[model samples]
Target: FVFADVIGQIVELTPIEVVSANGKETHKLTVELRNEKDERLPMVLWGNFATDVSDAIQGRGENAIICVLRFGKIKVWKYERSVLNAYNVSDVELNPLTPEVEAFASLLSSVYIVMCTIAAIESDMGCYYLSCKVCSKKVLNVPNDNIDEQGDEDEMGFHYYCVKCKVKNPRLMPRYKLHLVVLDNPGNSKFLLFDAIAMQILNRPCNELTGSNFEEMQDPEDILLALKDLV
Candidate 1:
């Protein structure tokens, strides 16, 4: 009958969509929240509460979503696992000016970066992908019968929440998904790059890699292009 506050990082979140319940269609959301100890659990947000979470900064188009849900109801799935079901009384914040976020920031900025040169396209793979424009993570696709004015099956109507940025986006975009082989001289390693870096290397979007441009070697030319600059 009641719920309390909990702080955790979102692990995975599905797209918000309208579902047929009883005799009507209604909006709903499911999110996986993880805590400092790496424990994760799912939380469901319903109606406007779900809508509000989807529209939040962390739930918006930010490439990643990272935030907290301070209150809600605890829901049990299958009478075994318990999940938090957010209600109208629940309050959600993105990058809230709280001690949890502050601690996360310090750990986030502590990562180190290294420089290396492209040696070879050892394992050239996917050149394009559809991902959350904000967090750049893969967006989940859930089918719903809810039709839009365009009768488009309302595919674009799904709001996908990102755990890294704690935001949600209604749409997905084509992005680069590349794996490059690099070396810092005498040492070789596999390096992965995402949309932003790939765009910079090719000076083109992921959609440009047409079948006509693809070679037997599988995007060797794309590798050549990256060599022009230190990628």
Candidate 2:
């Protein structure tokens, strides 16, 4: 089957890796694209095209991208259904010029990007969850002392482990997690601001805030004062 053009959102992206193809090893980047109706199709890109697309998104630190692919041939696996393969002739267009993509911009324009004044900060919800910097995952604190052969006494040492990354580290980082009641001309509503926004509001990093006087961070007034200009 040949599709001259296809439009979809990248629902899943796989890391570029060397895989066995036709009994030979080659780098492959596989992605699952979803249409507006939620139908998904797997597409494979080889070598440079695969590495470029994968690196471009990773460098920008974006989760995913919607794109349009022009011309591809369908290939069927032994046990699986058909999937699309891109060759030298195929062209990829990001945020392509199409009615489907234009609709997204239209929706964005229709919605207002208003900044609301925070009426209340729910600091009680915890300013942040203790996380590991490398993985951005909640870390589990544990005693650093190694258990003896006979499960003996507790010694002086402590560290944290990141379950998501499946690694142990000597320290954990703090990332802000806040819930606030924000006021706008429309009215007041609760808004949850995660780590990124909170960092901008405080003008301090996750490490600094957690390392020094952590208790002072509990006061919402200090945070609101710093956010006066932003909101």
Candidate 3:
């Protein structure tokens, strides 16, 4: 049995999909891992392995994860080589504290602290999004026909759906996903701020402005004023 151990940062993760394999439905998830040398290797997880990795990422709400895959079988399809789980023998570890993992983590630049001035706030893209309370993943509203007898609309006239959680009418929360153009000594660049990081910068929660509305809307004048204070 050919086996390999891979340690790297998870650079990309695709949404889980159900595919017909041998007349039976099964799950498939693809993740790209980048090693310290900046080389990328694609790893495919099947069946329960796919679901487990997906749940772990959603549960942590982490932008980056250091993963170690051990005893994975190497397979080639269409002349491209990839790694796959060796059934129950394979193992997956996230953010493991090992000499190999620590050495690899030190070479990565994804985590950092910086001081910059806010040149401007990009309003064209808007700010904030309706997210699932369960998984903190972005959710969308779907038409629901199960209204009450009084004909009173639901909280937002429709129930929200989370594709990741596969739940209907799940609890919802407002999360910031804003873009900003920032400047420093060298040059200026655009930076995207996600839920937790954005909240730390603004010192406020997205619900303060959104209230009951789940639809996307531009930040109000007061929010814009607060952003200007950072300039």
Best by lDDT: 3
Q: Write the per-residue lDDT of candidate 1 for residues 103-214, one digit (tens) a residue.
A: 8755542323767877665435654545566655555444444545453436565445444345544355566556677888678877666666777877877545533332
What's the TM-score of each model vs. the native? 0.45, 0.43, 0.57
Candidates in descending lDDT order: 3, 2, 1
Clashes of 3: 0
Residue-wise C-alpha lDDT for candidate 3, range 1-231, written one tens digit per residue: 479997878866755666778898777888888887778789888888888887787676666798888999888879778898877999998888888888888898875576788887776677777778887766755655655534434545666677678898678898887778888889987777777778897788888756787667654543545556666
The CA lDDT at 174 in model 3 is 84
TM-score of 1: 0.45
Q: After superposition, how far is residue 181 of candidate 1 from its true place, in Å?
A: 22
Cα lDDT tens digits for candidate 2, 75-98: 657755444546677787666677
Q: Tell me, by TM-score, which candidate is best.
A: 3
lDDT for residue 225 in candidate 2, whole number 0-100: 40
